[model samples]
Target chain A: MRIAFAGNPNSGKTTMYNALTGRSEKVGNWGGVTVGSKEYPIKEEYTGGKEVVAVDLPGAYSMSPFTPEEGITSEYVRTANPDAIVNIVDATNLSRSLFFTTQLLELGIPVVVALNKSDINEKEGTKIDVKKLSEKLKCPVFETTSTEGKGLKDVISNAIELVGGGQSAPYVQADINLQNKAEVDAEDRKRFSFVNDIVANVEKREMLSSETTKSDKLDGVLTNPIAGILVFAAVMWAVFWVSQAWLGPLVADWLVGWIETFQEWVAGKLENSPAILSALLADGIVGGVGAVVGFLPLVMVMYFLIALLEDCGYMARVSAVMDPIFKRVGLSGKSVIPVVIGTGCGIPAIMACRTIRDERERRATSMLATFIPCGAKIPVIALFAGAFFAGAGWVSTLSYFFGLLLIFLGALLIKYITGYKYRKSFFIMELPKWKMPSLKFAFKSMMERAKAYIIKAATIILICNTVVQIMQTFDWHFNVVEEGAENTSILASIASPFAILLIPLGFGVWQLAAAAITGFIAKENVVGTLAVVYGLTAFIDVDELEMTGGANNVAMATGLTSVTALAYLFFNLYTPPCFAAIGAMNSEMKSRAWLWGAIGLQLGTGYTVAFLIHQFGTLFTEGHFGNAFIPGLIAVAIMATAVILIGRKTRAHFDEKYRLHRDGKSGAAA
Target chain B: MLLNAEPGKTYTVKEINTDDEEMNSFLFRLGCYVGEPITLISKKKKSCIVAIKDGRYNLDELLSSAIIV
Candidate 1:
């Protein structure tokens, strides 16, 4: 039997679903976190012995959908033939929630109203007489706090028992023309009045929702245009600092020690094996994968912090704070959520774009969101910071600061290129009441992400590392290349051409080029392949680097100056994310032209930024331009020319369209 | 008018004047239609936080101006 969970956005549907199904699907304090439907078998504890599957649908305000995700929810409950529907209602907002509840009750499917977030209502001195509400709605109603796992079993069991029992809606709309707006509006108003009448009968409140509350006072400060932006910057900086420079490295030092011991044990075991076999096993697999995995603590900590931030209802306020600035660039406050999520990972970040109402803004957000360095790029950032910059906090700080700057510039460029003119863009976001962020949820989220990180390290990064190691070891003739003759190896031969184009960016060696190319497969591969090619496994141990003076050794092994190393770091950080992220961009963009344009913009931006950094840093430090400056300038010039040409063509097209529209209007008047 | 409404005071929504039909109906579903009470909790330079029914929403100036209170 299938029991579908449906409700208004942020009404704890996913939380209840996660509790019943024991599945850690994304649950955030904001709405539209679940853009797609998910089905998982109910846990044995919830089901007793009956086999039940819970279909967790995206939240919808009504059966008549507003957003795409809302459409998914309404369509699923209508057509999917679910045996029962569990309409999770926010008890705090009974008047608004019951509008959808009534619609759900009319579907003939049995609906057990889960009065979720009743705990919030209780704290606010609000009371909903459950028996009275159930009697009025003619359905079973249970008070549930999905966060604490309260009353879930009762809700689930009641839903299961009513699997095949048909529902009878308490208030039904009068027969009216479905196509007429007036009829629909009049009927909807009547239905709302019915819901309001029930609310008036069943709910008693000591505090009105509209009265000024503590949360509103807090919002006054946090959503201030000037103070809010600074607070946002400081909060983001604190997250990065704690995860990268302070707490993260402190934990990583211990983890890297264990990883190094394991690497040594593997090497000890392979002592009797052939040199080729030993290198492939000990250095290629264990060393390379371990180097990537060593940064797991950093990424996990970041995920935990981000999850907490998402849980605390601050993101909605941040969006409201950023809407004006984002609007100036042709995006809206809704675009802020995706970029914030992008800091955790790009795929879900891009997926979050579905909540955005504007198509152009959504696509632009998906394309530009990845400019914020994600969890995968943490290893790359840490490696460069440790090796060249002595693990400076400014390195990571500058990376994210530049990332945001690039996103702003990129959005503006896209706005101009796409010829998006000023339109009346409406910004409205529900400010979910703030509560203490759950550490349990944060820990669960951290573990989920950690598991993904390890699996990715074991599979994609391992394969790429092994391939890189083998290619660097053997020449075109399939013979092992001797020391100092590594240029003859297959990897060198393949990466050399790309290296020529990267000469002006400094660090134009085939090894660095190969790492950058493999980064396209997965961003972590940059660290893994770097470890494989350089035969270094100690990228995460900054304390060891300092104590043993090994930081200089690692930097020397890569044969890059500090200036060039910073350039290379920027190159990897700003370029297109992994292929999976590109696939997400493609799906969100849904336009081949836009997809190609996004990739071109990212590539040009990365190259141009790196080239300028290298050239200017060289001039400042050594009093000369970086290598191949003329060629790099030509390349940047070509890209700039292409962008300008596209912008001009787009402007001309808009003008022509505008002229034609005006002419047609005048002609009609004539 | 919603834009000039005093904070901490409740007023009934007179109308929503946006041309966008979907946004209009969406707001209607949230109990922000004509004669529904909306309370302005706070107002900022660019946006204002309002309470419609039991939910608080931050609306930009443009959207706030469109809601005739």
Candidate 2:
């Protein structure tokens, strides 16, 4: 039997599904976190070993879908013949949530309404007469706290028992012309009145929502236009500083020591083996994977902090705070969610844009959100920052700030190029009550993300490192390249041409080019490939580097000055994300033109940003632009011209659209 | 009047003036419609926090202005 979990947004449907199914799907305080339907078998404990599948659908307000994700829910419930429905309603907001509940009850599916967030209601001195509510709605109602795993078993068991028993709606709309807007509106008003009547009878509240509360006071400080932006900046900077500089490196040193010891043990075991075999197993695979995994502490810590932020309901406030500023650039404040989520991973971030009502804004957000460097790129940032800048905290902090700057600039550029005219776009976001962020949930989220990071390091990064190891070991004639003749190796020969194109960016060597190329497969591959090619693995521990003639030796091997290194880091950060994230962008944008334009914009931004940094840095330090300045200038000029041409065409199209309006008005004026 | 209403004051919504049909319908679902009591919880330079039914929502200037009290 398949049971559908439906509810209003943020009413804990996904949270309940995760608890029942033992799956860690994303759960945030904000609405529209789950954009698609997900299903898994219920845990044995919950079902008592019954063969039941729980379908977790996105939250919907009513049968008539308003947003894109809400449509997913309404469509599934209406068409998909589920045996039972579990409507998870926010208990505190009973008056508003049951507006959708009545609609769900009318669907004729056996609905067992799970009044979720009952703990909140209990704290606020709100009481609901569950028996009366159930009697009135003609369904079984059980109080539940999905976050605490309370009342879940009863809800599921009740739902399972009613699998074949059909539902009977208490209040049904009279037959009317569904196509007539006025008729539908009138019917909806009646349905709401019915829900209101039921709520007034069953729900007793001690505190009215209209009264000012402590959270409201916090909002006054955190959501103030000036103070909020500064607080946001400070919070982000602290997240990076703690993760990258203070706590992360302290933990990473210990982890790297263990990794080095393990690598040494493996090398000792392979001492009697053939040179190629030993190098392949010990130095190539373990060394490369270890290099990538050494940054796990940083990634995990950042994930934990972000999860706490997401759990505490700050994201919705952040969106509300940013909406006014974002509106100026043809995007909504809701776009900020995707960009912040993009910091962890771009795939879900792009998908998160589904909540935005405007199609153009949604697509534009999906295309640009990846500018915020994700977890995969952290290793690269750490590696470069440590090697070139002595692990300065400002390096990582500056990268994130630069990313935000680019997002703003990119939005403005897109606004002009798309010929967007300022129209009145209304912004409304629910203010979910703030609570103490759950530490256990943040720990679980961090562990889930860390596990994924390690698996990728073992699988894709491991495979890429091995391939690079073999390719660099052999020549075109299928013979191992002679020592001191590494330039003739297969990998070197292929990467040489790409190196020439990067000459103007100051780092033109085939090794840097090779790392950049492999970066496309997975951003972590940049660090892995660099470790393999350089035969160095202690990128995190300063003590190890000191014994090996210090960080300057690693920097010297890469043959890049601090200026060029910063340029290269920015290049990798701003360019299009890994192909997997690009596929996500493709799916979210749902337009070939937008996808191609996104890629073009990313590439241009990466190159132009890097070129300016390297050239200007060299000019400031060495009194001249770096080599290949003229060619880089021509390339940037060509990109600039293309942008201008596209903008002009868009403007022409805009004028043409308005010209028709003027033509119609010409008659009135005459 | 929602645009200029003092904080902590309740006013009944008389109309939603936007020509956008979708916006009107969405507001209706949130229980922000004619005759519903709406409270102006707080006001900002560009947006206002409003309490409708049992939920608190932050609405921008344009949206709050459209909701005539």
Candidate 3:
């Protein structure tokens, strides 16, 4: 049997898919789009055992084929003709969820409605006549809680039975062309009204109960300008506390133990220059790759916490709190989801921007999501914190703020400086009334995400690491360290030109600079580069040199207070994203022009910000020294002036919605 | 106006399938679809936020272009 799962964003469809499929699914894209799909096998023994293939198409509101995701789903439903489609709908928000259902019905596929988040509706004092909705849609409806595993078997079993029954398939016109689509849709409010009336007849509710009321009360205060900001601050503080206090020490200790046992075991077995020891132990495995592996704990812990908040629905609140702030900066709150998700991974973050319907806003959001310090870069921040600065959280925080600054700068530049622009897009979304989160779901999501990160590292990053090691280990003519370090190491030569770029950042010395260079490939590789660069015993134990009293060690050492450490962090956070993100942008924007446009903006932004920082900090600190900082300072000023002037010229044109009156523009009314 | 109609008063969107073309570009796109009752959820600082089915959408002063509460 072939079954496709479809739903709106956050309708608990993914949660349900994961719950039912367990670890049997693979997450990937369809053909070209960056949107991820989950596919798994479903087998049942009835009379005789046979297997079913279930594909979880990307979550989308309508099969309009407006976006790549919707297009892929529409194609699947129409052509592949899945044996059945389980349309997962959020019970609490039936109106919005039903919009998709209405369209799905027209597709004429054998539909089964998984009425998810039923408790959310019940708590809100609402009751849905599932029988009626099922009758109206002409399908079986199962009121379910995907997270709780309630009604899962019934939902899928009925789906399988229906397929087995050989029910005559409903015929839906594959493509209902909307010629003069905009005008026709505009004229068809009654069509939408027809569905609305159907919902009114099928659903009834009183006022929300205490649990629902409490969540609203919390949202009321949590969304209040002053209170919400405070709440946001508290939330960030919690994340920091967990990251610094919990993850830092726990990971360091564990890695130390793992490295010690392995290091000694290797030392005992290998001779001075055993080929295996020289290549896999030292170069291929330990040198660069081990550094990346060491930071896996940090990445996993941070992602786990982020994923938990997202599933529990608190992440939406965080984005809401920032709406007012974002709007003022010419960004919508929806764009913030991608930026927030960006802290976990850029690829998904870029994909997440699919919800932004406006082309300009989506593009802008895509441009900036990479600016957020995705988890891969965490080890870089921590490395700088440990090596140069005395493990100060301030460096980490400054880097984060720099990430924000670059996003803000990119938005401003796009809004004013060029033809690239966005008409103000509204921030609209369902705020699922909060419920007590399930720890089981959170842990499962965490493990799944951490596993994806590890697998990608093993496949993609390992290949790159081997190539880099081979090149660096070779002395041009022959392999110096081992046969593994052949004359083709791509990294060492790549790291050469960047030394010129890093000169002003203090520790631009090639080895240190090489670590930063590797950062652009995958943030995880920076830690690996450092381990190999200095021949450090373990990735986390760089502080072993701190005990030495020599001026050179201390001078060369970087701990929290060093401005250079902060400066390096700034560059990494603000710089252009790696090739994977660039590839994602290429696909999403669907144009080489837009792809290059985004990359150019990132480079321009990074160079400008880093240049300003180094020049100004030097001017302030070590006395406005010689020719060191002046030219860079002037170049920075000119670039800044150009961006500002361009932005001002376009500001007036963009503000058709708001006219500037002496003080401020007359913005949209309350 | 249903005595329930006041500028800031919250109303559950009861069957709002209106033939309002001018509104579609702004009001409708912001999750203000029919039966997804929106409350004048809040009037913070400068504008109001609306609650619509599992979500809350913020609309500023220019909502005058589409909504007439």
Predicted candidate 1 versus true structure: per-residue lDDT over A1-670, tens digit per residue:
9999999999998999999888899999988889999999999888898999999989889988877778899899889999999999999999999999999999999999999998998888999999999999999999999998999999988998888889999988788999999999999999999999999999999998978988789998989999999999999999999999889888998999899989999999999999999999999999999999999999999999999999999999899999999998889899999999998999999999988888889889999999999999999999889888888889999999899889999999998887765567899999998989999999999999999999999899899999999999999999999999999999999999999889989978999999999999999999999889989887866465342454666788898999999999999999899999999999878999889999999999999999999999999999999899999999999999999999888777776776687774322110
- How would the candidate models be sorted by lDDT, starting from the highest? 1, 2, 3
DockQ values, each candidate: 0.92, 0.84, 0.30
Clashing pairs in 1: none
Name the top lDDT candidate: 1
Candidate 1 segments whose C-alpha is farther than 4 A from its true place: A542-548, A654-670
Name the docking class for model 3: acceptable
Return the TM-score for candidate 2, rounded to 2 decimals.
0.97
Q: Tens digit of lDDT per residue, candidate 2, span A1-670?
A: 9999999899999999999999999999988889999999999898888989999998887878888999999999999999999999999899889988888878888999999999999999999999999999999999999999999999999999988888999889889999999999899999989989999999999999889887888887777899988899888898999888888878887898889899999999999999998888888999999989999999999999999999999998899889998988889989999989988998999999999998889988998899999999999998988889888888999999899889888888888787766466889999888878999999999999999999999999999999999999999999988899999999999999999989999889898899999999999999999988988886886454222343566698898899999999999999999999999999888999889989999999999999999999999999999989999999999999998898888677776766687773322110
- Look at candidate 2 and give me any clashing residue pairs: none
Fnat computed for model 1: 0.97
Better of 1 and 3 by lDDT: 1
State the C-alpha lDDT per candidate: 0.91, 0.90, 0.63
Candidates sorted by DockQ, best first: 1, 2, 3
